[model samples]
Target: MKRKKFASLMPREALKRSKSAPTIVVIGPSTSGKSTLVYVLVNHRIIGFITVGIGDKSQTTIIPCNFAFDERIEKDEHFAMRIRIKDFSAKDVHIEILEQLAKLFASNELSTEDTLDSIDVEWFQNILEPKDAAYHLGKMEKQISIEDFKESIADVLCAIENAEPSFSERVKVKKKELAQQKVKISEIRRMVFEDIWGSISDDLLARYFKWLDYIGENITNNLNLLLGEDNSLGGIHDYSANEDDIFMYGGTILQTLFDPFEPFSLIVEDITLACRPRTEIITRSDENIPLRFCLRDTMGLTQIGMDSNSIKDALDIALNCSPDSILLLMNLEERDDVIAESCDAIAEKLSKATKLDVPVNVIFTKADRLIGNLVNKSNKETVVLKQDDYDATILGAIDNMEENIRGYLTKLPQKNGMWLSLRYLDEGIDPIQRALKNQGSDKFERFTPTGLYQNIDEIIRETQKRILPEGIETPLFVTAIDADAPAVEMKVEGKMISNIFNSIQNVLTEDNSVVNGYTITTKYTLSGRSVVAYYNKLQRGQGHTTRANVYGNFSINMKAMLNKILCNEIPDFLTLYESQVIGTVVDNLIDIELEHLVQEFDKNQHYKDLAFCDINPALISKWSDKQRNTQILHQAIRQYFSSSEKYYMVMDKVAFNLSYGNEQIRKIIDGVYQKPISYDQTMREMQDTFKKIFATQAFSAIIAKEIGDAMTDLINKMIILV
Candidate 1:
């Protein structure tokens, strides 16, 4: 994409030549130097003032005042000119003069002072000589034709009424024409000088020039209307007075005193009595007279009656004025609730009404009051208070009066509104001054090194690690104890838990790759089975056939794999089981509480990294009498399953249901010599039982499928080894 070029700033030459002027609206708390500043800027002239009234009554400044320096000039004895300065800046003065000079002059070469000085006796008398003046005035009156001057003068006299017209009458007519000529000359001269010299001027000239410029520009643009306030000081009790007296005594006797010729900058000590709106009194009767007053008119600076409410009206006016920035001056010394409330209300309304996203700075006018209260004061260094501190004190006060003034705005169900900041201007550094300096800086960038968004990111990362499950592949099951007895109580035997955890880990990590110096496919699932002997028989009976089939198919395959491992076909299990025994001894070093034992086991690296191992029941019988040894092994397995808390934990973690209809199958197997049960019937019954178990517990079906796949893989490896 092509980069766009930046627009050039307005040239000084163009600004000088431009006829328009900018308007500045100054507002602040009652005595915060608004009017004083305006006086100084206007060449120390107090052109306007605002009266706030005395005591409990509220008073306002009304009417817009225009101040400018007028220079009068004379051209010849008959003509005089008035040149009014229109605008002023640091560079030069802009002025308006008469228009007649355009007829005789092609170039503007005459200065105002030069033009005024040139009006000496010769030029005056020469232009006003009897014959010449008569001829000129006649031409002006269209009384005599240039071709027949003599005859036309006689005819012009005949048209005059019954009279003896004097020579001075003609000269009087000539004077007016001369005055018109002087005005024209002045206008042309001003235009010419401005064209050449631009508006550059010395300090004194610059001040007056700017003053005049503001007046003319404000008047033409209706800015005065925007700044004007209502001045009728009508008492609320006016109707009680008699009709005749009402007209005389209804309004307050106020006067709007202003010095229009004064300069822009003048220090004003007290505005309360110095400035007042003008008023008149009327009499209705001897005892019922009342004061009458006129509503101050807007000085064509702005239009009146733009809105229904005063606040909205003022806001509309402010927005149109397009203030560079707003300074909300609050007087902290008075601690006046009403004054603060009014300021807040105005600020809120202005923010809502304005088009420009103008920054508003709330300046606390009397910060010296809080100087003594500051703790942790930095004498030589600038103190920086946290946002919370400002919100607690300054904002808290505003919120107290206007309950909805603070952060309550965010709770409202609305979108796309202005954002505001609550601040205390402070004694040392003025917030408004800082705001003016950084008016257009990035709002989101933090002034301090740290911010809130940085803290939120850290919290979210910690939460993610705690909740997501972790493993390397599919068909993975996490072993956890699932015990139920309304809550079972058991002494935590550290050695037993650690042995179980390490045993599982050893099985899972065991290498099954070497057999006859050949690499074999050796992979196993690290799984845990419940050792609790007390089973839910009712649940088992409901799905007897289905459970039997599952045991015969899946569980039997897993059992076969264990048989191979136990028989030393896969020597890794021998080492794994041996390690489990040794690890159990090492576990006795730790202390454990029963409630905490479950979580500790889950957190253990041994349990998390454990691998599966297969075991054989037949090996036990072979070591002794087949029947007696088999019974002993069965009883031992039952006791282990029944007594170990880890048994139920593994069932829950793996989501396994071990109840199967093996009792009937056992009976048949025991009576194998007496009555032979068909293989078809037995296998069919097992399949039915497995299907019923899966149908009864859908979640168990998910675990069963995963276990089945793992078992199948293990069996295939064992078969290959055999």
Candidate 2:
């Protein structure tokens, strides 16, 4: 009954007044079920893994993707209501808009009793298998000495660097000797596993390896940054190379560096799926309602080496943000100690980055799997524990886990540190894992879950007290419902997910998190607004001689295009390319928000200077997947727009939304303004023109519509990547 009442309240009720939704960044290792959790959060259904894509949920979230619930509310003559869930996008947006309008016409009954419960229902069965990533890692044979393997690689590199082209026999014999010590597949796999994750079985190293793909990928993509080297040395002195053989050794270092794994990374960059959930009632006294926030997904922990690129992008997001709390997720099947230790490392890094004491809440995923063990192992085990016993076991295990992770969390000077270690609250609110170092010499206050707040306004009021802005992190243990598994006694609502959503919702609605409304202070350029042209695929290579580089039977010329842009040659063919890039950038956010983001960009930072970046035109061989391609393009746009010189001077001035062959624009922009641009002189002349353009907010409004059109426009067509 409480669960039903909880769902009945609109998510908006748990917020502060703001222009943009606050961001709740979700960080964890791979195989953590983040994508499905986001999907279910928005759609309220567990579509089978097959429908989600390959059994790998890790790969499904190519960017830091977010999911939000779509509300379909219908009021009954009585006070009771049934609120269905859907994503706040697509056709559902229209249906919901109508439903909202209908509510204005109908009257709602005055509540005699404040107590009302609404139940959430699942529409489909969960077909998620116990898809494990580290299951085989530990069991691999470790006969290969890691030290020896390193030595051999070093020897090979030494041979390559020292070998003179004039002599051949000696080099060939040395190369043959190195080949004899050929590294086997198993040996290399173990080396990679140990190198990336640390040693197996005993410590956080294992957990790091286990989740590298997930959380690690999240950094590169952050749903979208699962964010991403080499050298030489010694004993192969006898090896000599013939002059003609010099070419054979080319790219050897690079090949050897990446020989252990495929070049493809599962996720390309951070993706954020934005959402709107409407399930609350309007309070007559309430004012300053805040806009909802975005959720950013980040990659997990691994034995990140300096030579690797994956950790470079992720470290900033995973550690630097100033959050009110940290929702650390731990898999139940894994060791509690490992999870605790890894979480501590995160907390430690977070403390160093933000220097604030943030709460670290360890929420365990796949808790239901504890019950599954009763049935699956009923025959093999001597005894099976009941539901109550399992609950006790889990609670007791948390107590034990505190001790394991407390060592890292309380490592402050002279004292164990002041924390809800659980420490005291400020504004009746205190950070979970902030820089515990500065919170005085007091001992840990205590440890336990801070009870749920009855009024979300309390949270907002508390947050406003901070002099500096800080975000809150809420860890939620997602409910795992397996349609095939036998029914268990646990109530779905009893899980901590409800509390998590409420906490996250409250954080998202903060004023500081929202975009501040801004007035236009910059000049506009509309001289080239009328410069429209039809986009033609055949015309792409016409701008430059190198524009049509051959790749298989097709032509996707990224190199030639870049060269022309640098040389100030704005080609007409780029119009089509720019459209594709813009479409992909908005389609997938590289660690940026989704629904709330559009509104955020629309309101405060409108009229972004048009520019282009990357959408994977090609790699070393062929085109990459949609995820990486989207990431590449999204980053490119972000890169171009972010640079003052690149954005304001070069691309925006020269490339005014290129269109080719009638695909986009039908009219021709002949007698194009082909003249040298003197910024100082040009600005003086166009001052009045820009003033007139700024008078109308047309350009400001066009961007939001353009993003919308890009989404709808691509729906009818497909860009094939083979």
Candidate 3:
């Protein structure tokens, strides 16, 4: 068989160029199907080129991979990122460190000064060796030595031949056609040596898999290890897969095991995800709003790294990328705890802890899977669910999600969450309402956003009976992904994604709600059925085979959502999140906590390393300088916030902190009150020291011991007559 040329990575020169277009960074937790979604959007240009690692357990992305589908635009301007920046040190992953970075960025502790002058592109170039690993894996993964593989094959055939379940009888009793392949395993291997090169017969493939299924669980796991993929996700014999999908399946496995990006994700970048639809949605009263924006994916946050973080360089990158919007993807399969973590992490990264940062959308992926699970569970005894029951079940699931996020998604402090409302309304008021007020009604021609909010409420009241509880106030949508769905379908989705970019662009550009530049459009969908799936049950089902179509509002959008929540100069935020500010007050509190705690006298440096006589005057000056102790106790706080944009930290050079406007941290005197680490204890120690030196210890010790009455003798010696 002739081999096709394998897809390769974009060149180093291409990777070094910075993005110029308005970017949209896609971020999500691992297994959110992020890479697969990207592949479907770009439609197949990337499918054969990069392995998306669909079925593996370990992480596959390494750095931000910028993807551009447009030939006219430079590819360097847009990026898909896994922002676990630094060297490729996978074992050294520090969620706390990354969280601290995010927190510092959000709280303004980190800055560009701490960043490397430039990303080391040369270092990134060296990781291409994974391609060779892929080659070997795709070729050698199918077999052990000839004898061992034959023995394994024989074992499966023997099991079938002497079947306890009577396999041949079952195949015969059913009307199922038997596979005609009579060949052994060795005969099949000659047609293809690599996984991606096959166009083999299904009958022959089935026979091979049939043999594989006879093996015990322990043996199957060992075979998976030999093939160089993790067995945790699945065994080597995945019966659920179609016979032809083996090639892509093999590619996913190889990518999981030896993916070039895995090491790179450990470093500072990520690479993957592209697609923007050219379609438009008709607004209320019939106006077309187009969708046009670049997509980028970034490193996912760990459980801890999502909510609270302090970092600077990541913020600098954010400023550099200057994305017009942010889209966060969440897997519906995640536990409730993970859902909360994902939301908190995103809110913090966008610099809004209480709610999502401005111009952001939360997209829930895998909704289809969630629905499938619930349906399957219901069908366990009988495939029974009425239309109302089905809708109610999904609503309950969404309600559970809302409940988990109630703490973080509280009502907006003022303005009913239209708080810090846009100072300038960009989208015009509805002409119909204005005309009506001008003609008949004198009072209802609302100029403010008050009318728009009221209009939305009326629409929701009229449209659907179910709405998420009022307490969960964040702008949220749940959409299902099909990974390979058509552009028209856009996953089990069509609406939210189609409308998201247009709404965000409007917010960022004009701070407005409607695309028509008129009043907020009442025509937008508050909730409606956009996902439709037709499925038939297996003919073998005892409950009787049936075909039915399910309609769901799986994809939802709240048009102009960002317009309500986005405000760059929100003073309420400054006051509400003041605890995040780290400056003189915070630093002083840190100092007081860390210093001033008095150690015992024997553990003091001047006493521990030397005897009383060993400390000469010069040595005493050095220790008081004392020579006894090595000073392990250092001044505590680093990255003191000096302003909203800059932070100061302690470092090697006294002047190093000055570069970023940081304060110079003075050295603390060991076991003494140099700078009060603990103010009260240090003062008590000072008072004791003052009493011993000038009040009592100043008198001769030998004379006091010799005298019967020390105080009387000392007073008489001083001046009896006086």
Best by TM-score: 2
State each model's CA lDDT, in order.
0.25, 0.26, 0.28
Question: What's the lDDT for candidate 2?
Answer: 0.26
Give the better candidate number (1 or 3) by lDDT. Answer: 3
lDDT of 1 by residue, 1-722 (tens): 33222222111211121111111233444444234323322211112221221112212232233211110101001111111221211111111111121111223222333333343443323322222111111112222122232222222222221123322343344345456445444333333322222222243233333343443343323322321232221111111012243222211121122222122111111111111111110111111111111111111111222122433334433433323233333344344544444554554564332323333333333332332133223232336654333323443233342342233233222212222222234423643223323444332212111211121112212222211223211111111132111011112222423433343324323433212111111122101010000011111111111222111212222221222332232122223234332111112112222213223223443332221113355654364333332233222222323333322222221222222222333233223211112222323343344333323333233333322332222211111010
Model 1 TM-score relative to the real fold: 0.18
Cα lDDT, model 3, residue 356: 24
User: Which 10-residue window in model 1 sums to the lowest lDDT?
Assistant: 525-534
lDDT of 3 by residue, 406-492 (tens): 543442121111111111133243332333344454322233334323432332222111111122221111111221111011011
Best by lDDT: 3
Candidate 1's clash total is 77
Q: At residue 110, what lDDT does model 2 achieve?
A: 12
TM values, all candidates = 0.18, 0.29, 0.28
- Looking at model 3, residue 579 earns an lDDT score of 28
Q: Give the poorly placed runs of model 2, Cα more than 4 Å off.
A: 1-20, 43-58, 66-272, 278-288, 299-317, 320-326, 356-362, 366-722
lDDT of 2 by residue, 1-722 (tens): 12221222222221111112223444544444343334333322222211333234233322223322212111111011111111111111112212221222111211111101110011000101112221111111132122332332232223322334311343344345446556443332222221221111223223222232232232222211111101111111010011233122212221211121211122222222222332231121123332233334443112222111222223334333323333433444455555545544554454433333333334444433432443334343336444433333433343444454455355322122211221124522222212121333121122222211112223223222221111212211111132112111101121222332233223222322211111112242211101111111112211211121110011222222322332332223233233343333333222232323222222332222221123233551363343433344333333323331222222221212221222122122111111112122222233223223323334223322332242222211111000
- Between prediction 1 and prediction 3, the one with superior TM-score is 3
Q: How well does candidate 1 score on lDDT at residue 558?
A: 21
